[model samples]
Target: MYRERASRVVGGAVVWESVSDGVAPVRVLPDGCVDLLWSSRRGLLVAGPDRTAHLSVSGPGERWVGLRLPPGAAPAVLGVPADELRDRRAPLADLWGPSAAAPAERAAAGRPAAVLESLARDRLRAAGGADPLGARLTARLATGVPVAAAAAEVGLGARALHRRCRHLFGYGPKTLARILRMRRALDLARAGVPLAEAAARAGYADQAHLTRDVRDLAGLPPATLLLG
Candidate 1:
């Protein structure tokens, strides 16, 4: 089973989950968010922004606590380009090395979510905060704004915008738009919107468009995602 809640200290969500039976495949759908995860058995790992469903298998009796970082925060907080860890689960030691990794390891022991927030704040204090432009771009894209217009609004040309997106979000603007659209559709459906209306509201050409995107991003059909 799994349970999650919002974090007051962090920009996104935090979750605690347990699995007691034999290892089972867990479909983690794309949401353009990065997760800092801790397991009693496996220690600290960063679950990177995914372009497709990430099927995770956990050991029996495994317990996990995770903090999901909002886009644009990962690079500043995790001290790595989003592109470097895209579609990957990486050991914190690999990026930060032993000295920095030691503190993160210690943080895993007590209040991992709060520790993650503190670490992010400290990193921002030293390295400066996430790009303000990136945050603005994310907001624009989340509302289905065209990439070209978003780029112009942010005063960046196409190539520069693409490069900045790779650094800040691990993918180009188009991919980020698709992920944001999918999340918006799911949120609408979960809130009891009809699938057809949700698709319309989320900027899809039609329900089929929504279905195709959901299948590609989530590995599930919209009907199954909403009703099952």
Candidate 2:
């Protein structure tokens, strides 16, 4: 049987929880806000305004769907300038969806894991459309090359790439690279590797660079999340 783990952060006005492992995707509650999400498995993610967070129940691929307005709409939904939406943090529930709250409650209640699984399946059914640009972006990210080089490889001019990336992922190439780099570092850190070694292998300039990226993207120091 596959095991599952989850963690919650409270104490602020916004409550956040993340669930991982097992086969089901966690449902996120809609709290009327935008969210920033990153997927560790495939380097795929979505940042947008939404009412719920849904996951694919049939498989473990990192997939997400939601409604995001054009860059001009960022200020209206996220309370930030259009450019800032790429890096800003909003309420997790508002960004992901209403269903996210359910798993936390279930886990707290010690309910059977299967209950969450069912919810994931249901959410997956509701998740629609494969964002074409998102798919292209993930394919480029998997190559582990620099963004400019990746954009060239994909036949997109620098400006064109920036526009498309912002339209689809809510961030430009640099921000997405940082997010992916941190995710890669996290995977390495979890594999029992030393911090320096992991940082090097994951393509950071140094351990300090990796540390800074981790803190920025995950809102915690690397050692706390990676080691603990």
Candidate 3:
């Protein structure tokens, strides 16, 4: 079983899981987010933003917990450009050094999700945290605004916006906009909207545009995703 809820302490989602008697297939779709994960077997790790779907295997009887940080939060809290970790997963100890053991120890005490939240809180507090402008940019892009307008709203020129996005989101604004739009369409499709209608509502030029974008980012056609 998999469960998740919003975490007030960390301002993201806390996810927990219990795997039963089979190695379940997990499909991780790109959302431009990053995660701090802890497992009884894996200890502490970071999951970076993916540009396409990533499939992973989970063994039976395994337990995992994670705190998913929103798009801009990881760069500030982890003190690394999001580009460095793009499509990558790394041990927390390797990135943060021996001091990283502190969070692992907290997780070992039994509440891994809460420990992940505490880790985020402490890191954000110390780093003096996420750029509000980045969050605003994400919101604007999510609303189907053009990247130029979003950049202007955030007071950055086009090239400057690209640089900021590369640093904070591991991609330029155009790619971010594509991913966001893909997610919007996927959500609408999952909610039972017809593909063409969902594409229109999510700001695609047409159903074919939506289909191509979905395949590019999700590694599957809409019908396959919807069926599975």
- How close is every model to the real structure, measured as TM-score? 0.91, 0.49, 0.94
Native-referenced Cα lDDT, model 3: 0.84
Predicted candidate 3 versus true structure: per-residue lDDT over 39-83, tens digit per residue: 777889888788888876666766778788888778877888999
> Candidate 1, 43: how far from true, in Å?
0.6
Q: What ordering of candidates by lDDT runs from best to worst?
A: 3, 1, 2
- Highest lDDT: give the candidate number: 3
- Worst ten-residue run, lDDT, model 2? 7-16
Clash pairs detected, candidate 1? none
| lDDT by residue for model 2 (163-188), tens | 87665555577766666667677788
Model 2, residue 76: distance off in Å is 20
lDDT of each residue in 63-92, candidate 1, tens digit only:
777778777778887888999989999877
Instruction: Give the candidates in order of TM-score, highest first.
Output: 3, 1, 2
TM-score of candidate 3 relative to the true fold: 0.94
Q: By TM-score, who's the top model here?
A: 3
- CA displacement after TM-score superposition, residue 55 of candidate 2 (Å): 20
The C-alpha stretches of model 3 lying farther than 4 A from their native spots are 10-24
lDDT of each: 0.81, 0.48, 0.84
